[model samples]
Target: MASSIRDELLKVLIEHQPHFLSGEEISRRVGCSRAAIWKHIEELRHEGYEIEAKPRNGYRLVYRPDRVAPEELAPHLQTKRFGRHIRYEYSTPSTQTLAHQWAREGAPEGAVVIAEEQVQGKGRMGRTWHSPPQTGVWMSLILRPPISLAEASQLTLLASVGVQQGIKRVTGLPIQIKWPNDLLIHGKKVCGILTELRGEQDQIHYMIIGIGINVNTTSEHWPEELKKIATSLAIESGGHLHRATLIAAILKELEEVYQEYLNSGFRVIKSKWEQAAGMLGKTITARTPQGLITGVAERLNESGALLIRTDQGVIPVYSADIDWKEI
Candidate 1:
């Protein structure tokens, strides 16, 4: 199959790095013809790999692509199923849109769809998510967990925890999670998550969780409206980061946390999220469609809804526009 052949080609390149391997030698190792080897090399090149082909030396991997293709990301990913089957796009309208369609078609759990750019990406409450090429992580995860709708919100929380841990692991930047699903570094927004679920009355079908992180984008790359409130990994870390490594780290973390969630409940993940929360126990303003409510963010309910205590009463905020500066 073409997939197996691609995997074999990637394996050869990864194992025999820097050293040039002749087409004849690769063909022998992969049990394919010299022409087949050349075809695979061309395919890899088209996928953004910078492979150098010499007259006699054959192909040498001069540079690895930063894109999150299976060939480039498989070796780095440490997971059983999550992101094991990756659909990577150079640009798309939205990873969420593609993943939703796949999930509807009975895609397996932990399937991942990633894109380098999204022209019409959406966030919570239909807000526009800014996704430029080669600047952010635009990906979606499809989950077919056997849980009730009430329990499904925990997936967003679990994803937020996973992203927080991943960023800390890869970039060593101390980032915090804003309730629901937002990753903040230095009190600015760096990442956002939008979770969509499809199911029957009581039984669940699948959930599509979309995550967008501004990785290498700078202030100038963002529109003037977002530059003041948005920050990227490069700005926070003072260096350019390998996006593939970050994606791998995130998939690993997501797999681990998701396993834990399936075994236990959201208590474990909720505790971790609350610890990393940026506004717990602090007074903040919740801008809801109804009206603005100034309250102290108390804690997360069992179903992962935010509990806000106002002067009048305790309100369970399913979703809200949060301003951390008010805290």
Candidate 2:
């Protein structure tokens, strides 16, 4: 993918950090005119880069923005595919909705849509997700993996494990998975994953994998009833976690784990998911579309279904609102 001229200009500035290069030097390096270089510098300033211009000295990056925008994450991203193309915003109703629309418009695979705040975010069962401004990782990724629709739920499991790994790597906090979607720390919810699909029955078009992690959120940020249930990386670790770093780590881990799955099948991912699940012998009630069912949460079956051993016998739960009410 070809970068915009402004991006090329920003690259030059970042490459010469801590020392200002002349306008003529920048133009020579980027193969653009002095006027074009000045135009790009103004655009970079608008993108939140602190560039200083001197009479003879060129631009130098004093500080970079704390945003998850393409320019912000481009320097930090290590994954070859994920987040290579991004659409970033300050506020939106939902990144997942925007990502789906972008996919329909022929956005490339691994395209990502991220927002600093989500006003109408939702999770499984269409439950509202609290996403205040600049407090969490609210993003969606588009995947065009070579997997069948029957294997869709596995993507959720893969992402859940990826997030757990990423959070652990960044904060050293041991987070656990609560079955299909929720991530728990000290028995409180910290993250959620929502995976949606598109395309014909067999021919896949795209998959939208949405992950929302409460990074810098504090206890006071939660409402009264949610105080005991929802927590954050900052709350768990007692320090502020960089949302961009976590996002990069998540995309990297997700791509790596997913690549492994693509080559070796679901065995490895399923095993990791089970170990991170932390709910094998426990019993709980889950609210499904049919009704509430109580059973001992046994283990993940082959297809990533939650196998609950009830009195009637073992049954596979494909989707549910896991009762975290007591947690």
Candidate 3:
């Protein structure tokens, strides 16, 4: 109820952008009391909205900060289902953890969990992701696909492709995929995707895809170890980007590609993934559970495994950390 009122209040203000709306008029439009309107306006101001208030003129929205709140993301979203139901948080332990709990409680597909800052962000293989406040996108999407577990693993690759397309659409940067789920910009890491699933036997339950992107994070924000390997859109684009705009674009693109995957199949998505994937046909080494394998990078097989042309023979790697020496 409070969220609805806030949304309604923001709607009124946006509708009257660059123009002052009297307190009474805004209260009437939002179906709230004048006192409530003033409180909400003050809250918005605290959230980085610049509202100029005058004794006679009422209030005018002067500036809007690049926040990923629902109000900021709604206008930019073009997807039919994705982001329709968003669980936004100012700070959280991990969006992925919350998404899992939500999925267990029957959260609908296309529902998303977004956080401004993640105190305990997760990465692939139980690693900790570096997530700072207000400078990146930390969100988890819920998906319920009626597919086999083998096919379910393919979604990670699909996510990489979807995120790559979205980043390109928003930033116009030359982004590339590093195998299964990492996005690289100018050979530096900019984004990481972690796709988890829950199921029993042949049946499936739901999947949570956590996506973390460094949008406007500056070089100084990174620790010493990450400074050489990590990067953000602002660093590469030479300007800060609006987090909400990028989030909306990603949700749209991800939804489109997801629908395409369900309708057509993984063939098309695989082709797209390979095209955007970096280091194909290059010499690389992967650390697999069995052991380390060094081989020439080959194309992905039908099952979405990274096939490597080793000296012995061609082997399909299901999961591994690829070391792209050149990249």
**Model 2 accuracy (lDDT, Cα):** 0.85
TM-score of each: 0.92, 0.87, 0.93
Root-mean-square deviation per candidate: 2.2, 2.8, 2.0
TM accuracy, model 3:
0.93
Poorly placed runs, candidate 2 (over 4 Å): 1-3, 12-29, 33-35, 52-59, 324-327
How well does model 3 score by local distance difference test? 0.92
**How do the residues 1-327 of candidate 2 rate in per-residue lDDT, one tens digit apiece?**
225667677767766788989888887877888998887777778877788888877678898776776666765678989999999989999999999999999999888999999999978767889987889999999999898888888988998988789888888888889988789988899998898889796767899998888988887777788897899998889887767778888889988998999999998999999888867777888888899888988888899999898999998898787764334
The most accurate candidate by lDDT is 3
Clashes of 3: 0
Badly placed stretches (over 4 Å) of model 3 are 19-36, 54-58
**What's the CA error at residue 204 for candidate 1, in Å?**
1.5
> TM-score ranking from best to worst?
3, 1, 2
Q: lDDT value for candidate 1?
A: 0.88
Give lDDT tens digits, candidate 1, residues 224-319. 999888999999999988898899999899999999999998899999999999899898888887889898999998888899999899998876
Per-residue lDDT value at 212 in model 3: 97
| Winner by TM-score | 3
Between candidates 1 and 3, the TM-score winner = 3
